[model samples]
Target: MHPTTPRIAIVGGGLGGLTLARVLQVNGIEATLYEADINRHIRLGQGGTLDMHAESGQHALHEAGLDAEFRAAARPEGQDMKLFDKHGTLLSEQATDEDDMDRPEIDRGVLRDILLDSVNPDSIQWGKYLKDASPLTGGQHALHFADGTATTCDLLVGADGAWSHVRPLVTAAEPDHSGVNFVELSITDVDRTHPAIAELVGRGSLYALGDNKGIMTQRNGDGRIRTYVAFRAREDWLTMYGIPFDRPDVARTVILGYFSDWAPELTDLIRYCDDTMLPRPIMQLPVGLTWASKPGVTLIGDAAHLMSPFAGAGANLAMRDAVELAQAVTENPGNLPAAIETYEKALHAYVLPVAEIASHHLDLMISPDGDKQMLALLKQFDAMAAQGSGGDR
Candidate 1:
């Protein structure tokens, strides 16, 4: 479409989608973002915190011209991380460097709001859940929505996250359970109401592991301690446990039974949780998955490579993909097919290491010798940090 406006449609208003829209807007390329949420307030408690890395998330934010906003909202102290075994003995703790912005933390909702604010309000169409995408002539596709509305776009980008409907267009890989499930719970106003747990968790993340099971907690930006009770079990194990997720009290009691031999301090995580629980089954697509680029369709973020959160690269890679794809389109303008080919090639190479790290970390974190393995890994990281700083500790 030469100098004419290209009808680019981005499905999913996630960080990647929003970042793509903002970066394209910065380059004078207007694109529409179709979000499934009814509105911005659809989920007040969207998710937990995210740490943006310099090479990915922060880089994308800078490209989108939101560096100042991101810096203002990021929490440097949230980088503090502690690890322990089931006995409640602290294995290793990493103190945060107040001056380091390499991986600053931000709440998922806050980051999303920042991205949303930077984009053109008219470009986001909320509540437009994609139903199907039909290929059309001239490298265009028609998007059908659940609300009986349809639109056509010259370029269709899917940043819709795991279980994406758009992934089928490029690859047939489905997300398989990673042999782990997390029962998520939280304690509100933890600093005051649950001082003990707050102190145990510190300002950032804590991992207590043993017996092939684990209890993980991380402090959110809102002073709440979000906890995940993880089990290396079969896909239907939680359902078979017969614990009612709706009744947090009973569920917490029943869940604690599995960890009866664990230290009381560690078990307290589940004991003092608030009256809400969510079952999260970890799933991941085949590692290093790639596909031949289609004429008018592409994907980013979890849609492109769905991996477990162990590597802490999911969000970072998503934003990185957004920046790369946006720049590809900006550079190639009228030649979208070439742009997509270039973007996909770079994307495949970029995501390979991340996927491998995520897979390896998940295996180590949940294996029988997880505690020893994790502690050794932390010591190696400490040694690397010391060496990088020209010091030995």
Candidate 2:
């Protein structure tokens, strides 16, 4: 190691942070990662499958030299999607074959594990939750951890998610609720235990929207089906509506009551959910969010621009940001501040348009006529496909 190699510290062990670390490693730049989880297993069931975009997520993997590994674990079948209305009437479906590798899907946990395995294990310090970062002399920052430990790094990267502890250092913006919340439920062993749901979900995902509400389901790699009952409601609807999600049967009944007028096949999703349920409020930072370049400090991913999932660009953009930042650091070995400034300049330019599109999609998808609008959008996509110009879904 060079004696003056920048002492880099990354907060958050998500795909963005891990990708940054891996990319830096490939370029012979060492960085230490601080993760909140005790170990990898803590994130085993964190999120659903992710469809890595060719231009972003997969590009980062290629930069990190994990393209072959990603291909081995990627699922082309998971790209299939079925769109329906509340009446269980299928509006449009996108069927994918084994060779459709443009946007292959991989379980979130699996991708994280693959990245973790590739990075130097000793470089990652697990169980270290960031408390705060204080600017110091000489363009460095002091990172204070919740466990009463501290470290000083010449370059500090906040790859943390929406509720980032590091975001306050660079930006004052906070994540605002998008007037939508997801009540998550799951059916384990869907293939054997719930054949009907397994068939309905197919190999990928299903979206059934109507009456300003939606029932969305995604099939997981472990024969589990994760479902989200989306509601365009107040932030406290879960408590105020008296869903009693703690009790499995009662919660299922109450949840189904809201969708009683919908088709029976759609209601079956909520009825068969396992006892575990989680209420997650959709939140996003103001679109076109940008912060002045703080010397020795910067942010990426949700820490920078938190947006709704309707655009399906969150993870993709995160990994893209990671790659660009890593390249910037590698290019300016003698001047980190310059590298950070260049990265932020390019980042703001790139994320603003994507964020605007995501915000627009969120509004349209959760509106009262979401099903109708979504159907129309799918029709346009079908037309594009027919013309052989549908590059990516």
Candidate 3:
């Protein structure tokens, strides 16, 4: 720890926390990052390509001095977005590379690795789940971990995701079901085993939509494709289905049963899926999620504004928050509340609009009036592409 620098504690070593740590390190500030997982390798890292906008994700990476490393691993081919109908009819296509699209595709796992490598080796403290955290005198806070360790810091930032333990201290916000749950699947060794799926994903993303359901898939860097069997249902639907959400065999049956009539190639995405089936029920904190200012503590990333994945804004927004927060601290040294106030003031404007767009996209995707709404989205993207603005800025 730098003797004159701030002592910051970042909970949850996801993309957001990792990025914040890197940003702070580049500026000569030290941060201790706590993650719940036993270790980094415990993750399957199956989430699809995040379309990181130029001004958001890319900009944050640049600020962290990770642009070169990020580019080496970025999948420009993953920038392509393709839409299909339930009957396997192709409706739309859009493509980009490293030069044109700022939001180049990179596996979530790969991105985390690059960010993790940028930080100090000892900076991240894994296996520490948040048991509780509280404010102490002299603008410090005590953080208690589930593993019987305790630490305190002058500044605490919750970069943890949806179910953040630190959130209750700032606001009463919590996540509610978003009426959509994704049963995630992966066709590993796509080039060797699942050539059909490899082709279907077409170097990037595939969105096949139908009545109250969709199949979202994306090409991973490792010749594998991460896919999701998305369903629109009431919050209790999965519970009533009696499907073992964690087990692959059971979840696969529940998923394939829903799309029973789909083509063999498509349903094969479920059959050939690996054992790590993730039943990710979408949840979100209320948009415009904010609270009264408090000294020495704040939130970033999903801990701050958790919305649906529809808008593809989660990672970008979270990375952006890290950058803004770092800038805030740099500009207002020794004035903790002033720095936090600066962060929230800028964050509200940046996050609120994106969250609204995300919520709206999720609502439209799951609504009774679906197909046309999807077509409209396709058309909107086409129009943007036509104007030479596919992913510019």
Candidate 4:
């Protein structure tokens, strides 16, 4: 390793941070990754499935030389989607062909494993929680960790996620509640134990929305059906509503009470879910968020632009960010400041339009006529795709 080469340190082991490490390694540039988890296996069951878009997630994997592995684990069938109203009336459905690889789905854990395995294991220092980062002279920063240890890096990349400790170093903007909350539930072994629910959800996703609420479900690669019971409510609704989330049975009843008027088939999901539930308040940083580029410091993924997942672009964008940042670093050898400036400029310009679209979709998804609006939006997207294909031909 060249002594003048930047000593890069990435904070976070998420797809973005891991991809950055992998891509940099592929280009013969090494970056140390600091992950809060004890190890890779600890977060195996935390995240749900992710659909890898062709231009972003898949592209990043290709750059990291993991394309073949991703294809082997990818589920093209998971592209299928069924949209319905609260009455169980199916509004729209779309199925992908077996060869449809444009946006194949892969479990989040699986993708993370692939990235984690590709990098040099020794480069990743697991169980290192970043408590703070202070700037030092000569474009360096001192990383203070939770375990009373400190390290210095010539380049600091904050991939630490939404509540990032590194974000304050660049911007004071914080994530705001999007007025929507999700109660996540799961049903394991769905094929044998809950065939009916399996059939209802099809091979991919099920979205039932109305009355400013929704019941969304997705089929995971692990033979589990994960569901998100969404409500357009105050950020504190979970606590103020008096849902005994600690007790699964009582919590199910309390959750179902909110959806009393919905169809029985839809309510069955909440009733049959496992004894675990998580309340997530949807949050997003101000769209078009940008900051002055701090020398030797930058951020990617959720730590950079925390947006609602309604547009399904969060993971894809994060991976793309990693790819671009890696390219900038590799292309501008011995000029860490120039690399940071280039990456930040391109990132700010690229994410603004996508962030606006995500915000718009969030509003449409949680509205009273969300099901109808979503169906129409799907049709519009299909028409645009067809026109683009025809033009290419």
Candidate 5:
């Protein structure tokens, strides 16, 4: 390791990795980011919406000097949420004002563009699919890529996602199925072509949960309605269910069979989806996963704590981790090991409770009485908010 400036390598070009690189550069430190994507354009229109929490995601952007850009692109009205049951009974609805920025929503692709544009294009090595990473003497690491090329750095940060290749260097923990499966579908030109769905989904998100199953939909900025048909099933159910996923029409019919008794309004989402269907199995690491602090290597975001999307904390936490890690490195100066230890300790402490909450929410939403349980939980939250407001008054 260099005594004054340690060589930093960030693997994975997700929000966390990109934020780290941008923040490091803002602090006058240089780091190389390696992403598997062939180019930045490949991520366009690839991911769904993300709500940037004020204290985490937004704070990270502020640290990286992209606050103005993020604010311009964020949608405060996208905080609107509607909850329903299988019978199309509206259980609860929360609508946000245009100025409500507590957790403003933004398209994932747009957020990535903001971070990408903030960093120097020359610092990013696109198409570098990391094969593996090995430890070298004196707290350094050698990153081997799939293209028969390699690089070494004094500090290695794995911002890679759930199946991070660099995670094994620290902990043996792998993500396990959370018993929830999602069939993702989308409807483009939603407002123009699918007026019924646009009306049903409202502005932001609609969640219809019942019979241990769910149909979740969100309106994207590009006039698309992205939906996830989620249900509790065996990890291998998608493979064995015999649905012709490749044929969108046949797959839609087959999928609708599961929700035959569901309301027409909720089932129409699947009936009018585009030709793409993506099957995703929710996976999670242990609630309080931790590892012995290894020098030159550490993890952030999903690489450290992979949880179901129930809590909606994945991206927020990833950006928060980036901010914390960058601060640790910049504050610790040349002490690379100390910086990693500090960041890991803080990450573990903060992520434990969030992981547990996410696990609990996943269980509640996938149970036989999911709708009833969710309604009760929402009422409890309302009561808590009322009490807090009363006390403040």
Candidate 6:
């Protein structure tokens, strides 16, 4: 697919985009990245701890030669997970001891920092939010940006996420909303600022459940913790609930009101939480989200298959796609057509099961009546805990 080098442009600066750029560079292929954000540091990138799986997410990091850096940011103790009822009774536990566990935890922001540091700054062009792109001539495409800037590329890759601009080049599809709407809020410096909430949350992931509502919280690095308060609602409920979308205090109030029936220890997170409340409407592409061929354009990560975070495989699957696509290009020396075909074929087969698992799990997590689903998770957690002490091991 190249005479020494391919004039490639990668759209997006998320994990999958950076992984592709880093891995391709390792193989001596140069690719430029276009990002929508103003700059890396300006983007907070804050969130919960991502449990980097052994064979998928971690393997991709190793392939990119960023494993040592990843370890530097890993929090082994954060892999410990707990499930509980609305009344705050412990149902089960996993990764209890945190020893011999391979799936280490890292804050989303820290993980992004490691990926960004691995790549040369010159490789990324920030604030290039794309509005439109078109095929030019002889394997080239012109990119039109929101800022009215333009550039051309010999090969374009879409790592832009679920709402990818590059996806339409290959297929006709978009992300559909998953049933759950997540009201995400955070508690800063839990060990110091909010000791009671920290005690309620402990050292790992927390799942407090009821029939239709639930809360998932996890301790993040630097004495901070992020919590997702989940509710099953129509797509428009976020606005209907008067969640001040931008102000943290307004969002905090809206989310707290949902769980007003619960204990003060649980609802206290809202009162003491940082005001940055954001409504996350869970969305995903089709389960078997595959697209037909078009020249010089392909996708990875959420852009390819954005599923619910139920099975916790969104990042894992995206990393898998990057590795597979890279191998396809690296393997097929001459025929670009053959390379893309092979990559797409393999990706379709590989992602279907995970997508199905993701869909099924989303249903359980956001069901109209979630009790049966909560019971299922409790049973699974107990089973896993009985088999192994901590999720880390």
Top lDDT prediction, candidate number: 4
- The TM-score between candidate 1 and the true structure equals 0.97
Candidate order by lDDT, decreasing, is 4, 5, 2, 1, 3, 6
What lDDT is obtained when candidate 6 is compared to the true structure?
Answer: 0.79
Select the stronger candidate by TM-score from 5 and 6: 5
Query: Per-prediction count of colliding residue pairs?
Result: 0, 0, 0, 0, 0, 7
Task: Judge candidate 1 at residue 143 and give its lDDT.
Answer: 95
lDDT of 6 by residue, 1-393 (tens): 445356778999988898888888877777899999989977775567788888788999988898889877887888777776666667667665555346777887888888888888899999999997888766578999999999987678899998899988888888887777887878788888878889878878877777578788889886888888888887778877688877776667767787777766667766787877778888889888777766677888888888888778778778777788777777763555667788889888978888887788667766544545767765765678888853321
lDDT for model 3: 0.82
Any idea how many clashes model 1 has? 0
Cα error, candidate 1, residue 74 (Å)? 0.8
Q: Once superposed on the true structure, which residue ranges of model 3 sit more than 4 Å away at CA?
A: 1-4, 245-250, 385-393
Tens-place lDDT per residue, model 4, 151-238, is: 9999999999999999999999999999999999999999999899999999999999988998999999999999999999999998
Cα RMSD to native, each candidate? 2.2, 1.9, 2.5, 2.2, 2.1, 2.8
Model 1, C-alpha of 253: deviation from truth (Å): 1.0
The CA root-mean-square deviation of candidate 6, after full C-alpha superposition on the true structure, stands at 2.8
lDDT (CA) per prediction? 0.89, 0.89, 0.82, 0.91, 0.90, 0.79
State the lDDT of candidate 2 residue by residue for 1-393, as single tens digits: 112589999999999999999999999999999999988787647688888989899999999999999999999999899988888898888899998988888988889889999999999999999999999987889999999999999999999898999899898999998899999899999999989889999999999987889898888887889998999988888878888877878988988999998988888889888899888888999988888898888898999999988778899899999999999999986788889999999999989888887877767777787888888877877789899897333
Residue 194, model 6: Cα distance from true site in angstroms: 1.5
Candidate 3, residue 345: how far the Cα is off, in Å: 0.9
TM-score of each: 0.97, 0.96, 0.93, 0.97, 0.97, 0.92
* lDDT per residue (tens digit) for residues 277-367 in model 5: 9899999999999998999999988999999999888999999999999999999868888999999999999898888889988889878
User: Model 2 has how many clashing residue pairs?
Assistant: 0
State the lDDT of candidate 1 residue by residue for 1-393, as single tens digits. 433567899999988899999999999999999999999888768788999988889999999999899999999989899989988899999888887787888999899999989999999999999998988887788999999999999999999999898888888899999999889889999989978888989988999887788898889998888988888988787877777887777898899998898889878889988888989988999998989999889999999999988888888889999999999999997888888999999999989888998888888888776788889878777788778852111
Error of 3 at 10 (Å): 0.9
The TM-score obtained by model 5 is 0.97
